[model samples]
Target: MDILQYEFIRNALIAAILVSVTCGIIGTYVVIKRIVFIGGGISHAAFGGIGLGYLLGINPIIATIPFSILAALGIGTIGKKSEFGEDTAIGIVWAVGMALGVIFIALSPGYAPDLFSYLFGSILAVTSFDLIIMLILNVIIILTVILFHKEFLAISFDEEFSEVVGVPTKTMYLLLLCLVALSVVVLIRAVGVILVIALLTIPAAISRRFTHNIKNLMLLSIFIAIVLTITGLYLSYIFDLPSGATIVLILGIGFLLSSLFEYSIST
Candidate 1:
């Protein structure tokens, strides 16, 4: 109760809700499409944007947006058109992004005081500006999903069938990856680049155990993510743990518990 009085805690709570919405909606597609690896790759690739921001003296988060989108498009195109496997493409981009970030940061004139925050996340440090950015991104994600729900669903379930039906499978795939990029940006503040995929995938993965319906899966995932995020925030507050890592840990535990529960029912 007393914690609510603190501005930082309130901000963290708001950010958590926004993050949960983005993750729940976009994550369903990622899981059903089995593009979790692409999500991870995009998240890491955003690091290059972060480094570019430092080098150019701009907002790292802003920089991450464009950089991640380009990376997502590149990975999608290369994986689809090239001889290299998808995993191989992801690996190349992932390493290159991290290396670029490291080099850019090193070249920057001064030590990056907030570098750790971006890597590990500092939800407790979220300000009003950050909250506003997150809110806008969440709204955009929701509306986009609502507008293209059918196309996304068709493409996710069966790309070949979707193409047969004139669904523009390739375009939809790129659009879905773009959404993943947006979700990654939204999550960067809450869980950082390194752990964003866990938050993105865990909730959807856990929810899938209970429901095969996409709408239900998303709703359940939103509920689970909100619960775990708030619980993790509170736990981090009480124990002085890293907020992002704590949230991921709580989510991991939820995944294990959900898996066990499903197994028990099956047996």
Candidate 2:
């Protein structure tokens, strides 16, 4: 299939690049703070929007933004209050959200063909409109991360010390999560909810092995993510494989190679 022959394939390339930007920037924060599971929680919480979208007869993509944001807020806020471990709260919310989505989808009139698209990604179905939304969201996430880099750095490195310096750790934590929610919205269609946490963490995690500075890690992760995503897109196009699976496989291979390379150099 010639890439130029199909509009969907063309738009999918664009979406892949935009989502690379999203995961690249946000993934740095997630990896640096060791919030890998938190990232998973937010993506899982996105299912809440899926169910609500079905019950309300609305566009799932549109419904997902607010629903994910609310879930992120709840997770961040309640995680602070609950006596149990943070993951405990995140897990409870995560399981409940998935259950709600499952029940609602079962209750809806017809089977939603597009459900799998969001669940496991549909690179070929991406439209130019989706690309535009993705690009705009990427810009927003990037700019916000840059502007608040100091505060986020303070929070991630040492929350108690940051509080001593009056950094407003609580608000910063909430802000970081909202950014994660937005990242999930951008990524839901490109990489699927199940595997996006890999896209969000692996490249950054590998990159961190070599770089101590957050800035370098972010740059390296973005470079790795863009390369892996583009390579995956091309492979999926040529071999007729699932795009999301291809992307995850590519990232997994990249992670292994990066780890090996780092170890070899260190040894």
Candidate 3:
């Protein structure tokens, strides 16, 4: 409770909740649709946007929004339309994005301070501005889900069938990837690009064990993410560990425990 007295701590808490909403919602789609690789591609590709932000003296997260969306669209387009496989498209975007980030950082004048935080994360250092950005993105994600609930659900569960039924499957898939891109941007400041996939997928995967229902899965995943994030945040503060890595470790442990428990019940 004493930590609540600090502004940074409060911001971290709010950001965690906001992020949990998006991760829970979007993460469900990622797990169900089996597009975790695409999510990873988008998250890592966001690093290029971060570098562009640094070079241009702009907010890195803001820059990452458009950059990540483009990455999502590109990967989706290539994998869907080109002769290349999805994995191949992911590899291409992944490598190019990281390469561009390196070049942009090199071109930027002066040292890039707090670059480690963007790469690995620093929840304790989250600013009010970051919280605001997270809030806005949360709204966008929630609204998108609400507006396209049926379309997204169809695509997640049966893209080919959805297309057969005239559901505009490609458009929906691309839009869902864009949502994932937005979720990646939301997560970068808290868990960073390196570990965003864990937050995105782990909670949703765990929730899937408990429920096959999409709405229930999202609700449960959000709850799990919030608890894990808060627990990890405090533990990191008490022990002086990297917050992002700490949170991801907790998620991994949660998944392992959930699996064991499920196995025990089945046996």
lDDT of 2 by residue, 1-267 (tens): 466677777788778778877887899999888888888988888987877898889878778888888878878887888587678878977887788888889998988778887888877888777777778888889989988999999999999999999998999999999999899989988888788798898878778887888888888888888899989988988899989989999999999998789889999
Top-TM-score candidate index:
3
Residue-level lDDT tens digits of model 1 in 223-258: 999999999999999999999999999999999999
> In angstroms, how far off is 133's CA in candidate 2?
2.0
TM-score, model 3 to reference: 0.98
Reference-based TM-score of each model = 0.98, 0.95, 0.98
Worst 10 residues of 2 by lDDT: 1-10
Model 1 spans with C-alpha error above 4 angstroms: none
Task: Estimate every model's Cα lDDT from 0 to 1.
Answer: 0.92, 0.85, 0.92
Query: How accurate locally is residue 124 in candidate 2, as Cα lDDT from 0 to 100?
Result: 81
Stretches > 4 Å off in candidate 2: none
Residue 11 C-alpha lDDT in model 3: 88
Weakest lDDT window of 10 consecutive positions for candidate 3: 80-89
